[model samples]
Target: MNLSTEVRRLRDMDWGELDIKESGGWPFLLQLICCVLVLGLTLAGTYWYLAAPKLEELGQARTEEARLIRDYQSKAAQAAHLEVMREEMAILEERMNTLRDMLPTGAEVPSLIDNISEAAISNQLSIEFIRLRSPVSQEFYVEQPFDIRVRGGYHRIAEFLANVASLPRIVTQHDLTLEPMEDAGGEQLQLSMLARTYSYRQSGEEEEAP
Candidate 1:
């Protein structure tokens, strides 16, 4: 049919006379328009049902991929500097050991006393007394004090102090008093001092009741 005839037929079509069960008996124009409408609705419904979920899944997958990339970069950076971290740990351990070695044990106290006496004798000083006092307890270590009395010339006493200060173990001298011996005609000088050394306590030693 011509375009104008088809348009006129569509415009003048009667809907009430058409039989619902006899679609094939309908006019050609009416049937063609119904088929086009059904096809368009079917295509739109199919796209919404099948393609929407896949688009959401693609978006989630992209987000997960970005998170994994960030994790890999962080781990790679740590691995790159692993050797430097190990070297720093070794240096810290060495320094800790050196400090531990400087602390003496209980058994070594007598030897330390002997060393002090020897230092005094080496400097030509008279060691009158070297007595260990009661130990003072501290948080991490025990302070072992000593009462030292010596008689010598000024230069000899100075040398003895320097030698004691240079010992390997940690020792501190304080409360020093010097007086000339009147009976020795100002030739001999008396020196009195307090010396303290430290020893490490075992981990649970301080917590125990005496």
Candidate 2:
């Protein structure tokens, strides 16, 4: 049919006159309109089903991009202070090494005890006894306690303790007791002390310890 006649016929069609069972006998333009409407609806439904997952995926991609941007900003800020962090780490390492040196290893225990005797002799104090007690094990080191007895003037004993404190290795004096020696005309005093020194435990020695 011509365009104008088709348009007029579509506009003049009566909905009440149409029957579902008689759609085959409907007007030519009306049948064509029905086919177009059904096709359009089918295409729309198919598009929605196909595109929904992709739309959800796009939203997830945007969320992932935002999270990555936040992480980059945080790491960039840390990188800006990287040199300062490295310097702090170096200082901590140096401090750890110094502490390690201050704590003597097990092999140096006898030499350390000899040094204590030498300290007392240097102070002109007569060493009565410098006894080593059994080593007490701890989490990281062993405590080597000493039972020390010496005879000297009060000032000499003070000088001896000061020299002990000035030793390169760490040694701590504890539980000091003093009594007058009557045989020396009360001019000498007997100083009894408990001293402690620490030694570093060797690695893997813990399992081998009896």
Candidate 3:
């Protein structure tokens, strides 16, 4: 009875009970709150330090990629336009060359004149007045002729005319005045004629053979 009562009295004592309550009190609760706060702060710091920069870099990369894509598309469009222009230029060049080949070259004038003179001699006609002049009208087939005047017998004149008619190129006589010569011989006659030679020429371009 003595031991049991003493133990009971000690348990019911206010100091002992207060000491037991203080042993496990608000300090522990404050330490637990501090630890929880530290853990939360560490997690927040980790997210800011590690994840934030990566997110920023990803956003920057997306922006740069978009810019590059736009540049590539613009360049592609320009390339297509250049290709079309090149094709058009090639076609134009081909057409221009074809037209050039179809046009005649004017380099045969000397030979043509020699042939005409030979034909005149073969026809027994001596050329007296052979005059060449620049074009007058500058229009096609309406220009003045290269002038020529001759004095010969009537048969020689007729033969010369026939020879001119047989030429390959178009040769025509204009402004003809035929009369008898006053020289002592009655067989001789005086002939005046104008002949025309032509070639083609465009504005600002050199003359060409036709």
Clash totals, every prediction? 0, 0, 0
Residue-wise C-alpha lDDT for candidate 3, range 102-153, written one tens digit per residue: 3323454455566668877887777786666665444432233566666688
- With a 3 Å backbone cut-off (N, CA, C), the pairs that clash in candidate 2 are none
Tell me the alpha-carbon RMSD of every candidate: 8.6, 6.8, 20.0
Error of 1 at 47 (Å): 37
lDDT per residue (tens digit) for residues 57-112 in model 1? 99999999999999999989989999998999999999978977887898999999
What is the lDDT, from 0 to 100, of the residue 146 in candidate 1?
A: 95
User: Would you give me the overall lDDT of model 3?
Assistant: 0.68
TM-score of each: 0.57, 0.61, 0.43
For model 2 the TM-score comes to 0.61
| Candidate 2 per-residue C-alpha lDDT over 1-210 given as tens digits, one digit per residue, 9 for 90 to 100 | 687887787788888887999988777888998999999999888879988878999999999999999999999999999999999999999998898899877788889989999988988899999998878888777888889999999999999989888889999999999999999999999999999999877766672242
- Off by more than 4 A, model 2: 1-78, 207-210
Rank candidates, lDDT, best first: 1, 2, 3
Clashes of 3: 0
Ranking by TM-score: 2, 1, 3
State candidate 3's TM-score: 0.43
